[model samples]
Target: MFQTSSALIRNVHSQVADRVGTSIVRGDIGVGETLPSEMQICQMMDVSRTVVREAIRTLTGKGLVESRPKSGTRVRPPQQWNQLDPDVLRWRLETSDMDSYLAKLFQLRCAVEPAAAALAAISAGQDDLTLIRTAYEGMAAAKVNEKFVAADIAFHQAIYFATRNEFFWPIAQMFDVTLRQSFTIAARGSHRARALVEHNAVLEAIATRNAEGAREATNVLLKNSADDLVRIRGREFASRPKA
Candidate 1:
């Protein structure tokens, strides 16, 4: 009973935190603007003061807001945000324009994934190769969008694991949500066929222990994905009604 109640309280606290965090990220609550008073929040949200406080603390830990003795809690600037934090990343994607978000996401992926692929080519063991191959096979066999996206995420995740680099694992995990979003976009129409071929090139290079080949193949894959995204964005822009 005690554990269940505690779990419920935690859920409420997270709900409050997400509501406030989304507002801040969406600029509904502008940066540097103070949040409502604790009593006001408690009354407005119909939750206890403790829940509001805990929620604020959660936001503070995410670098979303800060509270001082006299000054109330205020939203932090974007530069101060922990962008790689999963919750923050989700919020940013929710609020950002699609094109800008895709640009930044691809830039980060371009910098990290190729190097990770090269490392995987050098360091992967039999088990690592098996895991990656299984994920690739999953992608190849997926008949629906949902399954394909999951397999694509698993494929990249396996490569990061194969790198045998502890730091790269967390970086790859941080990208989980963004990867799903991007993979869904890139997999639209006939692009899936081309993507599978590019993915095979990556798998083949890693399987052959060719570090440079893996790097080159990963770069080609990312470039093609970016090009697909641009074309999709162009089509959407063209289809939009004129102001």
Candidate 2:
């Protein structure tokens, strides 16, 4: 009974946080604006004060809100928010700013992935190479759209881990959400054969311990992806109704 009740409370807490976070991201609740009072929130949400308080804490931890002794809780500015937080990333993607978000995401990838790939080429052990090869094979064999994207993500993750740099792991894992979205967009107009060719180029470079080749291969892949997104975004914007 305790477990069930706890789960119910947690669900409500998450629901409240998600709604409020979405509102903040959408500008319904502007930064520096105080949220409803604890009592008012409890009443409006039809939950206890504890739930509202916990939800507020969750948002605070995500840098969405901050509490002050005299001012209550207020939404924080976008720059203050944790961009890597899963919930915050989801909120940003759900909003109309996905193009800008993707641009930033790709920029980040361009900054880190090529260097990581180069490191992997030099540092990967047999087991690490096996893992990367397995993921590459999965990508090569994936027949369905969803499977292909999942395999693509797995392939990149394997390379990140192969680098054997503890610091690289977390940074690479943080890209999970955005990477899926990116591959989805890329897959719309991308050919499976071309993707396999590019992926193979990177994998072969790493397997051969050619650091420069691995770096250049990853850079080329990212460049192609960015080009595809730019073309797609242009078409999408052109199709939108004039305001």
Candidate 3:
């Protein structure tokens, strides 16, 4: 979704929002704690008060902070945050505990993607199939981690579009950063060849209008991905001290 966005340069307001948002999510600015006043933030960030105010407004829209007339803006509780916002998700993934985040992300994928695959089998047009096939070919050919993850995200995004379901599109949109990181973690396994096999199964099933087969193939792909995550992290977990 953010593929064309600049990585090196951003607007002053977005830069401030990201900085403050990351701090809030990281608990560097605790819930209910008031942020510095507009003047203070302007001085601290070396931006105008207008920019600071706009940044605060953006954060407020994301449910990360709330502002009152006299009280200023304060960080909100975890439950109050818009957890599904891609920016919020990226901040949490950047600053919070990763194992917990990936586990939850996998659970969400398990719940959504198989159903999407089944729907795609029933609804995809030729163009959709072509897109999916192209992405799958990219995955099969990728020799580096970066290429693999990019191709992998494109492959799943193709499936979401193929489903032709409005609701599934938003769910797929949510996967951008989370999905890439998960695939990167899982890419080291010996499962890449098997992943290609599973991908082909889903692709072929959708191409043939085999809904059940498509769903089952997606399940197999996800299960193996989960297995890969655990296998890669197993050694690190094993070495952790018992509580």
Point to the candidate with the largest lDDT: 1
Best by TM-score: 3
Clashing pairs in 2: none
What is the Cα-based lDDT of residue 199 in candidate 2? 90
Please write out the lDDT profile of model 3 over residues 1-243, one tens digit for every residue: 011222236898998888888778878888899998889888877899899989889999999999888888888899998887888888888875666777777778899899999999999999999999999999999989889888889999999989998878866777776778788888877888889999999999999999999999999989888778888987443233322
Error of 3 at 190 (Å): 1.9
Writing each residue's lDDT as its tens digit, candidate 2 over 1-243 gives 001111124488888887778778877788899998989877776889888899999999999999999989998888999978877877777764666677677767889999999999999999989988888898888878788888888889889999999888876676676678878877777566877888999999999999999999999988877777777667552234322
Q: lDDT, candidate 2, residue 165?
A: 98
Candidate 2: where is the Cα deviation over 4 Å?
1-10, 233-243
Which candidate order results from sorting by TM-score in descending order?
A: 3, 1, 2
- What's the number of clashes in each of the models? 0, 0, 0
- Taken over the whole model, the C-alpha lDDT of each candidate is 0.85, 0.82, 0.84
Per-residue lDDT of candidate 1, residues 1-243 (tens digit)? 001111124488888887788788888888888999999988888899999999999999999999998999998998898877888877777777776777777777899999999999999999999999998999999999989989989999999999999988877787677677877877775788889999999999999999999999999999888778768667652233322
RMSD of each: 5.6, 5.4, 4.6
